[model samples]
Target: MAPQLDTQTLGLVFQSRPDILAGIQQAADTPARTTLFNDIASFVYERLACADAPDGPASKRRRLDIAQPPAQTHRNGHAQDSVPPAGSQTGALGADAAVADPVLLEVKDISVTAPQRKKYDLCFTKNFLYARASGTSVPVQGIVYPWTDIEHAFYLPVPDKSQAQYNYVLLPRGSFLPTAKQASASAVDRQQPLEPLVFTVPATAPKPGSIGGSSAKTAEAVSDTYSSLFNWALTTSLRSAGNHSCQLVAADPKLFHSVARQPHRPNEKAVHVKAFRGSKDGFLFFLPTGILWAFKKPLLFLPLDRIVAVSYTNVLRTTFNMVVELDTEGSSDGSSTVEKEVEFGMIDQGDYQGIDDTYVRRHGLADRSMAEQRKAKRELVENAKKAPADGEGDASAAGGADGMTELERAQQEAEQRLQDEEDEMEEDYDPGSDGDSEGEGESSEDEDDDDDEDEEDEDEMGTAED
Candidate 1:
């Protein structure tokens, strides 16, 4: 007789699978990997736990949304004060007591939308730490006390059906804005993949209109189409806010502070960079891209001095080390050449320089295909169908109050978060992304907007904002 597997065991047995990892190899396969794996794990667990006997029929199971990341539960219970009676001592304290510093810890992970279907669900690796408890004084070792399990992945859930673009989800090669390299996918392509979660792809590539001197595809690119092409390509991928914000680089988190010194342009993308306020300095995370950020809109007036750190949550949701250094001398241009000398780029957790051909083959445009995609999508649906019959727990380990013991599984989720963020940060920084605020001076987003927009595009921006 076989030992029966329970939901816990089911989750445990297949805990190591990730979309990217599963595609790697079978020897690397874990339990509940395929519909078959989960089916087997489910059957085994059922046989063991069946109330009647080992011979009893197994019960039905359901698919769990592995993508749902554990909610952030701040370990430090900072006291929340209510609005006191007008002019009361309580009111004064609330106003003056240097409001409970909402510290920001930089995570190298970024979150981005897949361009279609998934909300900002990407993740990438970062060298930073997630403290079970808050405080920059001590180094973040690992999960502590109540947080026996550390969640490596996080998803920024965008409002369903909302017009806002949750630029944090990740789409495969032909996904959302699959670069010019990847086969460009359009909206009408219903075969277009949908994330396990719901999301929509941007309808078309934003066409930026005109610019005078440097040749880019300004709507009025005189006769220099090729030069315009080259410039447009860079502008579409690079952030103008001191190009340093999105390049691939590395640095010590403890050293840099304030986006001001680095002075991030509003519409710029963090790019291949993982940024976060180090655990040490208190930070103000300008997480205003979502509904909360749109409404609260704090970055505009928040005490700039109080912001000691900042980072990005891009499409893949990976955390990267974002080191923004401010120079009294000032950066010469917002382009990558000049920007890189400052904060630098986001280096991959793996051997970065060694990331040669092998790396490109794995992640580059070649990775996508119609047949491969169909096969992968079919398998996912199949697994989803059998999920309930198997009674499988979440193969993805999520640390909610539950006693989640699968650290390896948790790591898988974390990886997704990291990778997603990386891709998103970079895409957002594309010079022609048109992400900046309207006429608000030099911001990464604003610069990208100016680079890409034709006189006609400005009207679109206003409409899009609504």
Candidate 2:
């Protein structure tokens, strides 16, 4: 039986390892807090019991398939087995054990630095990128993303936000899976894919107040040059089309970051700076012809046909950052080619829907309004199916040869009541009826005038007698 742990001991364990709680919270379908606590308590109890057992360690080693040393024959002809030394190079043990695994690249001390900065240790193995919070070995918080789902990895820097500075993110290459309702309606063969996840790592930068701190000013100069270029591009594109044919869908004055890096080249270092202006200020215009944006320089006339995909990163409930991947030619070696992606940061929350709508329309995706209509129609059809057919009793209660549901009958009754009330009110306050009321009012006024005259005569007679 598992050892029993008291509440106090369980609380202490939880306090010592807060990552357990964090793991529970990160679950996609998180249980109630009380249930999670109870589960953790039970787990701790079982672990403690296992540790306390006499043969627990040996059993664990056996379960892990740890190899035992060969048995030796003693002078008495009795066989005895020797225990393996600690950290022995036997059966999945020792320093080189991980080498046998399929993991290709593993990097620690990395932080995701876009939308938000989060420390994560990344491991790439067998076409899957596994990520876990830095400094914690908990597998529950680890996420596995397939390489095919990853669209691109690039650097983007935004001003006025610390987390956005020196940021690199991996965006998803495809659209999200069908919603729960949609999946139920259709025969979905596959499970839902994960939402667009942005894995970010920060770039190296000079410390504040250091000699290299002047790089900030240099970044500013670069931003100004880009901004000027952007303005020129916008003017040039608009000039080519003399008529204002391009309808503006959305515009952002200050948004975007540009970074260029060539790892194979010796002198190539990652550059992270505001995109258009020194302050990361730039404009993004969604035009009918396509999308246009400028920051340090303008990316003018990016035709929709050239765009491969558009993805978004939610930024702390305030905004969404857009990532646009373009289909471009590869370098001669092909290996040296970069995946062309543009990041538009700090977009207004309200404009997200419109931008997404425009993207879907341009990319031949289902129309947003049409999708909504279909969803509503499906709901109506489902409700109709769930509703009962008119029974004999229901038809009799309706008292009409035309078949009607309870709701229709109720509506007809309500309309009849309303009509009757309106007719009564109209008769009570008819224009022709108002004339009789006016004549009666005049006769009453005349009678009142005669009464006044009589009272005056009585008063005059009394005065004469005095």
lDDT of each: 0.25, 0.38
Q: Single out the weakest 10-residue window by summed lDDT for candidate 1.
A: 66-75
The clash count of every prediction, one per candidate, is 108, 6
In model 1, how large is the Cα lDDT of residue 84? 27
Cα error, residue 192 of model 1, in Å, equals 46
Q: How accurate is candidate 1 locally (lDDT)?
A: 0.25
Task: Estimate the TM-score of every prediction.
Answer: 0.14, 0.26
lDDT of 1 by residue, 185-301 (tens): 452332322221112323223234322223222324332432233233223323321232222111122222122222233332221222222222212222212101111111111
What is the C-alpha local distance difference test score of candidate 2?
0.38
Model 1: residues with Cα > 4 Å off, grouped in runs:
1-210, 214-277, 280-466
